[model samples]
Target: MKTIHKIAFLMIMSTQLSFAQSSEDQKIMQLSKDKWQWMSDKNVETLAALFDEKSVFVHMGGSWGKQQEIDVIKNGGIWYKKATIHDVSVNIIDNTAIILTKMDLLAVVGGNEVTNPFIVTEVYIKKDGSWKLGSLSFTKTLSPSGK
Candidate 1:
C-alpha cells in the first residue's frame, strides 16, 4: 500500500513539473511569433522594450548590437516584410530560453526584395521578472529541391 502511494505521488509530481515546463515553452514560443510581427510592422518601441541592453544581432552582412539593429529596422535598411514560419522549437535552460525557427523570410534589403530560407536562432533571458531578447542570429539555408 505504501509503495503504491509513493509511486502515485511521484507520478503526480512529475506531471506537475512537465506541465510547468510546457507552459514556459508556450509563452516563449508566442513571444517569438509576436516578435516577427513586430519586426514586420517596424514597431521599434515595443522591440526596444523587449531587447536587452546588451543584445546582439548576427546577420549575413555583419553583426551588431541592440541600437544598431533597431536603427536598421527604423531606417528601412532591412524591412522584414513577412516570415513564413515552417517550424519552431523552444528550450529553456535555467533563466534562459533558446528558440530555433525554420522559415522563409521575405524582406527588402538595400531596396531589393527577396525571399530566403533561414534558420533563425533567438536567445532570451529572464531578467527582472521579464524575458528580454539577448541575441538573434540568422543562418541562411539551402532550399529543398524545386519550389
Candidate 2:
C-alpha cells in the first residue's frame, strides 16, 4: 500500500510540473504573437527586441542573420499585410522550447500581391531566466502548382 501511494504521489507531481511548463509556454507564445504584430506594423525596434543577439533566420528561401532580417524590414522589401498567425503549439525540453506557428501572410512583392501560407518553427532558449528567440525556420504551404 505504501509503494502504491508513493507512485501515485509521484505521478501527481509529474502532472503538476507539466501544467507549470504549459503555463510558461503560454507566455512564450504571447511574445511570439507580439513580435508578429510588430512586424506587420513595421515596428522594427519592437521586433528587434524579441530576437537574441545570435538569432538565426532560416526563411522560406534561405538563411539570414539578425542584421539581414532587420535590413529587409528597414528597406521595405519584406513586409506583411493581412497577416494572421494561429494554431500555435509549444514543446519544451529543459531550457529550450520549440514553438510551431501557422501563418497566413499577404504582401506586395515587386508590384504583385501574394499570399504565402507557411508553418514556422521558432526555437526559444532560456537565457538568464528569460526566453529569447534563438532561431526560426519557415516552410511554405503553397501547393506545388501555385494554388
Candidate 3:
C-alpha cells in the first residue's frame, strides 16, 4: 500500500511539473508573436527594451547587433512588413528559452518588396525576473509544396 501511494504521489508531482512547463512555453510563444508584430510595426522602443544589450541578429544580407537592428528597422532599411507564422515551438532550459519558428516573411529590402520562407530561431534569457532576447537568426528555406 505504501509503495502504491508513493507511485501515485510521484505521478501527481510529475503532472504538475508538466503543467508548469507548458505555462512557461505558452508565455514565450506569445512573446515571440508579439515581437513579430512589433517588428512589423517598427516599434523600436519596445523592441529595444526587450532586446539585451549583447543581443545579435542574423539576416540574409548580413548580421548585426541590437542597435544596428533597431536602426535598420527604424530607417526602413529592411522593413518587416509581415510574417505569416505557420509553426512555432519553444523549449525552456534553465532560465533560457529557445524558439523555432517557420514562417513566410514579406518585407521590403532596399525598396524592393519580396516574400520568403524562413526558419527563424530566437533565444531569450531570463534575467532579474524579466526575459530579454539574446539572439535572433533567420535561415532562408525552400517553400513547401502548395504555397
Backbone clashes under 3 angstroms, per model: 0, 0, 0
Measured with C-alpha atoms, the lDDT of residue 34 in candidate 1 is 99
Which is the leading candidate under TM-score? Answer: 1
Candidate 1 has which clashing residue pairs, if any?
A: none
| TM-score versus the correct structure, for each prediction | 0.96, 0.81, 0.95
Least lDDT summed over 10 consecutive residues: which range in candidate 3? 138-147
TM-score of 2: 0.81
Residues 1-147 of candidate 2 have per-residue lDDT tens digits of: 999999999999999998898799888888878777777788888767778889999876679888788878777777765567757888889899898888777875555688888788899889999887899887887732223
Give the alpha-carbon lDDT of every model: 0.95, 0.80, 0.94
Candidate 3 residue 44 C-alpha distance from true site, Å = 0.6
User: What is candidate 3's lDDT per residue for 19-133, written digit by digit as tens?
Assistant: 9999999999999999999999999999999999999999998999999999999999999999999989898999999999999999999999999999999999999988999
Query: lDDT by residue for model 1 over 99-126, one digit each (tens)?
Result: 9998999999999999989999999999
| RMSD to the hidden true structure, all candidates | 2.0, 3.1, 1.8
For candidate 2, what is the total of clashing residue pairs? 0
